[model samples]
Target: MQKEGQKSSKYDFEFKGGKNNSYVFETNYDITYEVKFKPSSYLFDERYQFSSQVFEMVIAVTESKNLDDKIPPDGLIMFTIAEIVTDFFKNRERIIVYICDTADARHLARARKFGLWFEKFKTTQFMKVDASITDEMGVIYMNALILHRENPYFVEIIDAFRKVTGGYSEDK
Candidate 1:
């Protein structure tokens, strides 16, 4: 975690696609990505009464290729994202989750599921339901940042897990 008025955390990482080189590119065999927590809004009152902080969590799948051209399973994707969020935030509060995949656009259903799941998370955590849309990609592009709950800014990224899979999967 960062200080009350500290800047966002910039993180870069890489990992193997999956077993049997499934998620690797046809040529390359690894996935390069970045998860950045950019602070947007700080709650406070007169006298600089800083209470909680809001961050725009940005995740980028910089390099990912599949031998069979198959995107990773939703479960895997959710698990990966959940872990990333949990590890990054580590008990922080007043956070907003944002993820957009306009590059390889999937379906709104995916985003809706993530949103609903986050909504459920709000029941227990400080997350916001209005955030966490899984409809579009690159919503949190390198330059695509926004104030949580502001117009044109309504989404959240997960950084904690009450259970495996973040309790988002209905199959469980």
Candidate 2:
């Protein structure tokens, strides 16, 4: 929307490769993600109450038209998402990642696997995140991953997810 080189002070990140940048959204089908979260966990039970501050980011993988072709054999998207998570941890940012991608089912499954990989990281304070994967439409799915500094119980939820998914538990 900002037309490549134009920078908006209102946004948190500027596109590195202009409009052609893989992260910039072209069609609604492109790789897009939204994050909504709150600073406090007291309203965990009341979902409708804590839906105030939401942050969104787009991650459109380039060089490929279909989902399977876009994902590298070495799992580059997972690695990049991991880096983003680490940056949030270092900055002490509490957020929920809503990944919406028009990729294949395998890619969405991979995202879930990658979310489980977050269990290996432990910050100074008890940090936990429960990543949920759900269907949005055909070839499109949403992964809602929540990170909290105060709740260590998130680790258990992630572990349970990993076990349920059965992909990340293969000892990679």
**The best candidate in terms of lDDT:** 2
What TM-score does each of the candidates earn?
Answer: 0.41, 0.39
| Ten-residue stretch with the least lDDT total in model 1 | 19-28
- Model 2 residue runs over 4 Å out of place are 1-52, 56-58, 64-70, 75-77, 89-93, 100-103, 122-142, 150-172
Candidate 1 lDDT, 20-55, residue by residue in tens: 111211112344445556554442222322223455
lDDT of predicted model 2: 0.40
**Candidate 2: tens digits of C-alpha lDDT, residues 18-110:** 322222222222343322122333223334333222233344444344465443343233444454545444433344444545445466665
Query: In model 2, where is the ten-residue run with the lowest total lDDT?
Result: 20-29
**Whole-structure CA lDDT of model 1:** 0.37
Native-to-model Cα distance after best TM-score fit, residue 89 in candidate 1, in Å: 3.0
Question: Alpha-carbon error at 95 in model 2, in Å?
Answer: 1.1
Model 1 regions lying over 4 Å from their true place: 1-29, 42-52, 66-70, 97-110, 116-123, 131-172
